[model samples]
Target: MTDHIDGALALSWMNTFTEDFHAAQQALTDLDRQAGDGDFGTNIASALRKVVAELPTADDATFASVFTATANGFLATGGTSGPLFGMWFRAVSRSTATEGTDTDLLAQGVAAGLAKVQTLGGASVGDNTMIDALAPASQALLDASTGGLTVDKALTSAARAARAGAASTADLLAARGRASYVGDLALGVEDPGAVTVAIFFEAGAAALSA
Candidate 1:
């Protein structure tokens, strides 16, 4: 089993993940500007930049501590996505602090984060929200683990699921958040939140695999 992940590697992954999130946010901004706020990209990027900057540097820093710092950092940035993303990170911190680079711990942390998103967002699968991407990714990670997949493989599976889920949102009707206000106008457009969630999984997987 891959244990004892280096702190510098973890930090590098976080930085890379932040960059991926900015790219995804830009895509969402392009997609949503047709009917919703054009600021989604800026908002997410701003929040993630703060997350990256605030990450703890100590080799002994626990996953929970890092996650908590990420959450607190993002929360301070202020946005609709801020509290939500912060909550997810908070869940990750709580679930994975003791396990470090352990694959099982990472999977469990992601599942916990997904559950928190659902609870906080009150949006289920196919809701045309971040949950759309998050739910599928979490399930995929869990399934892959049960099948004896490696951590890197499981992360890849989750990233694929997240992308598929985000793409599926293009056919879904809006049911929550600002997109809901547009109703039918929301159809045929990819959800910004879903896309960003996919990016999150992709970044996380890359970090762990590296």
Candidate 2:
């Protein structure tokens, strides 16, 4: 099994994420409609498309390069969640900051991304934000790294954690982000940002496992 993620793998992960996101776009939009401004799906879809278009060729790819491109794509998008996701990806790219990245390195990048998001957004685990999924996924990656697992297994575990976190958001009252504006109206709906985080880790797992 592979122990590291390179540019090619990173690109594949993003492509997988894009495909999955496209499939779930309407569902995500519906969720956002019940909570926020209802543009989460469309905005994020545009960002991912831009990221895919700007991705480096596999021959010239590196973990940092791909993630940096992703960060820039999201940063270019207009909205509170978009730029927050941009900064999170920015931190992940900085943590890699090199031509290659191992599972442990990727875990560090995820952790850094989580920290960057929380610090910038002022939302903790139960804030009904992306951080809900990101925080648990980061911890799962850290645990997997400590267990010395392969990249696929590590990412799979992180994906599971993120999914659970996203699911938890449905039962939570919004404490931050656009959902907060809706009050109890968002109670039964999952946070789109958190679900996106789950989709991200699931894509990473699928890419690495394949």
Choose the strongest candidate by TM-score: 2
Highest-lDDT candidate: 2
Candidate models: Cα lDDT each: 0.76, 0.90
Cα lDDT tens digits, model 2, 24-123, are 9999999999999899998998898788888899888888889999999999998888899999898888766455777788889888888887888899
Tell me each candidate's TM-score: 0.88, 0.96
lDDT of 2 at 79: 83
lDDT of 1 by residue, 1-210 (tens): 334334554666567778777656656788878547777778777787777677887675666666777888767766677788888877766655345645566678778888887888899987788888988988897897688777667777999999999999999888888888888888899988888888877886787766
